[model samples]
Target: MLSSKIIMTPKVKISYILNIIIVLVSFTFGFRYIFASAPLNYQLEAIGVHGWNDIIPEYRNMITTFVRVAGVGMTTASIGMSIVLFRAFRYGQNWARWGFAGIFLAHYIPLMCNMFFLKTTTESNPPMIPNLIAISIVLLSLFFSSNLKNCKAIENK
Candidate 1:
């Protein structure tokens, strides 16, 4: 039947769901953090404040560039990934498969610090919530990535 033509694989379905969730997380928390979190953290007297006495551009450049680059990448990628996720639902396209993998890596791996500890660089750096969401997304993606049916199997030119 036409209704049964779609695969409805749980793995692929979960991956699609997680992709949507990831998009929301990025747009809400990630975007807000990019615009405000770093400056707020620096403003905190408790964060070991060093005044603008030296104003060393090298150190400033290093730290600021790292934050800015990562923030911009997250913002742009989240938007793109959301589009890809929608495409996956309809056509199960090759780009979405690979895109999901990349998003999983970028969002998830940074959460794992060393073997045990987790690193969350948000302003509050709130206990485990930030990283927990990321970890959950990672697990979901891994469980449902449908990587076995990746670009190689699909006809993409």
Candidate 2:
């Protein structure tokens, strides 16, 4: 019988904790967008676009549709990331390490850039601090999980 246990170092433990935080935060925002449409509405209101649904029902519907779709995407992706992180990353798989970083960068870098992009076009102040903090957490997680040499128990498997 093959045992499925992998020993955890301090760095790996920290990585696991950070990954959990990422999943929790992602799910929170995702669910809020999906169920309440609060995030996009907040952004719209910040830009002084009040009563858009009353003034322009069609446009509001379209934007709401987009927000809900984004929410679904975020939620689903978070689930996938959790699976990868828990099953493979904790085992110190090299592929999982790079894959997690790549997925995070691919998903978030463009969104962060778009936030700044929107700032130039609209009067809205994009939530830069939260995005920065999220990126920092992910980077720290990656740093902790990378180049670990103590995962030899499962390294050859």
Candidate 3:
């Protein structure tokens, strides 16, 4: 129920390029912040932060594992998203929208939870870059996905 909209017009191409630009800007900052927080500590293990680990030793390991896993996910999703955006910038497409949505869905894993569970509001914590990116991605995806829907009805037999 989807197809590329590249042949539409030059206007559409420009629009898609603009959208991809926004997506790339958001994704870059989001990925950077996410990886910084959950840096890969392959050299050491279980360097749990204080005021939380005493009650749950398992929590430390769980968190460490989760961080590593999340990092992998984010990296993969980021690469996929970049591909979609690059395609959109070059060729334009309905798939770009759904592809962006997939990125948002992938981002919601650790990205959303971290914002929800670790929001300190103390001015010391980094801003919610991933959260904002996630929101933008979803919004953009739904917008373009709707356009694809209309095209699908006409294009499909």
Q: How would you encode candidate 3's per-residue C-alpha lDDT over 1-157 as one tens digit per residue?
A: 2343334344444445545665565556546545553433321222333334343666556655665665566566667777776655234456666776667576665565555444453222434674676466467545644554233222323
- Runs in model 2 lying further than 4 Å from the true structure: 1-3, 38-42, 45-48, 152-157
Query: Per-residue alpha-carbon lDDT of model 1 for 1-157, expressed as tens digits?
Result: 1121234466666776676777787776556646642433433322345553344667655555555665676777677767666655336554566766577567546634421231234233323556566767656675677553542223334
Best by TM-score: 2
- TM per candidate comes to 0.55, 0.85, 0.48
> What's the distance in Å from true for residue 68, model 1?
4.9
Q: Give me the overall lDDT of model 2.
A: 0.74
lDDT of 2 by residue, 1-157 (tens): 1245467788877877988898888888788778854346546855577655554667666777877887887788688778778777866666776667666677778878888877777777877789789889989988888764466554344
Ranking by lDDT: 2, 1, 3
Give per-residue lDDT, candidate 1, residue 14.
72
Clashes per candidate (backbone, < 3 Å): 1, 0, 0
Worst 10-residue lDDT window, candidate 2:
148-157
Tell me each candidate's RMSD, in Å, in order: 7.0, 3.1, 7.5
- lDDT values for all models: 0.56, 0.74, 0.52
TM-score of 2: 0.85
